[model samples]
Target: MSGVASTRQQEVQRIVDSLSMAIAQHRLKPGMRLVEAQIVDVLSANRNHVQAALQRLALQHIVTIAPNRGAKVARPEAREAREVFIARRAIEHAILAGITIGKMALHNDEIEAHLQAEEVAAASEDRRHIIRELSQFHLLLANISDNRVLSEMFSNLMVRSSLIVALYQRNDTPDCQCQEHRAVITALRAGEVARAQAIMDEHLRHIEQQLELDDAPPPPITLRDALLVSW
Candidate 1:
């Protein structure tokens, strides 16, 4: 019984992680419907498993499940968009305040690796991949802070931020700028904690500025396109 239950939990977690990655990557945009049959097909999971995954996501505010409409990626409101950034600024500021030269040194290798990945993704000009890489870079910084509680909090913020970006971002603006990330790293390497924190604050502000919160929402894509794993 324990073994079977554990396997079931793992399967559910697997589905949730995949969907979360797609959402964070901007491959699955806000307001996109998540058809169960399509999700089951794309993930090769059972119907029950897919449904369970969607339920978990809904609890996280990552998806919305309607009585008759089924589930769709969450569409955050304009007010919620501003609130998300405010929350992010507070959380990220705390994370940066705790950083030290020794701590930064510990994660230097991982940081460099993530930066390289970001550069490669940017060079490819694959928007989805670039978005995912950029988001992961921030998450990596949180993890480097070595505070599990803070890291988990930032993880949730990243998800909400992703949804907000999907709903409110302008077509012409880039999701993240690689040069800004590099600048933050350079500041940290020089033991200029204040400068690094300032850079991060500026970076977050730049991302939020790209959003057109007052603009009309985009038309939702077809279920097939939404669930297509390749996209």
Candidate 2:
């Protein structure tokens, strides 16, 4: 009995992780519909477990659930974008500072593994995979920071940021902001904390500049449409 419960929990976690990664990479965008049947099909999980995962994301505000609309990724106002970036800047600044002060270093094998994954994603033709890699790069840093709370917070923010980018992205470069990752990694490897932080700031600044937020209206969809629609 306990084993069955544990397996269900694990499946729920896997669904959440996969969806979060998809969100961060812009594979899932703001205002994009999340249909339960479709999600269950894609995640290959039961409807109940998928529902559990969606509930978890809602707690982080990464997704929103309307009474009859089911759930969709969160689409923040332009003002919210600015607010999010402000918070991100503060959070990442502290993360980098902690890494510097603690002189925390990533394992060589781990770094190489991440880089290899990035390369594979970059080389792939799938836009979704590319976006996933871009988002994971930032998450990897949070993990390296070794602060559990901050890591979880960053994970949630990363999901939201991906949605924002999808709503406002100005270019189609799958490899965007990748060089900045290399720069930060290099600085960290050299024990140059100041350089690492500088690289991150520049990287984030570039992302902010790329948003094309010009007050486009949300695509027309009512509560009825979302519920009736499969995906």
Q: Among these predicted structures, which one has the highest lDDT?
A: 1
Q: Give stretches of model 2 more than 4 Å off.
A: 1-5, 100-106, 116-126, 215-231
Candidate 2: residue pairs that collide: 25-131
Alpha-carbon runs more than 4 Å astray in model 1 = 173-176, 215-231
Error of 1 at 99 (Å): 3.0
Model 1 C-alpha lDDT per residue in residues 122-204, reported as the tens digit of each score: 88887677887898888887877778899978887898898888777786335548999999888877878789889989998
CA lDDT, every prediction?
0.83, 0.75
lDDT of 2 by residue, 1-231 (tens): 699999998999988887776666555657777888877776667999989999998988888999988998888888888778888877887777666433444356776788788888777756667776777777777877788988877777777777777787776664456668888888887778788988888888888998887554444544333332222
Superposed by TM-score, candidate 1 places the C-alpha of residue 223 at a distance from the truth, in angstroms, of: 4.4
Q: lDDT, candidate 1, residue 78?
A: 88
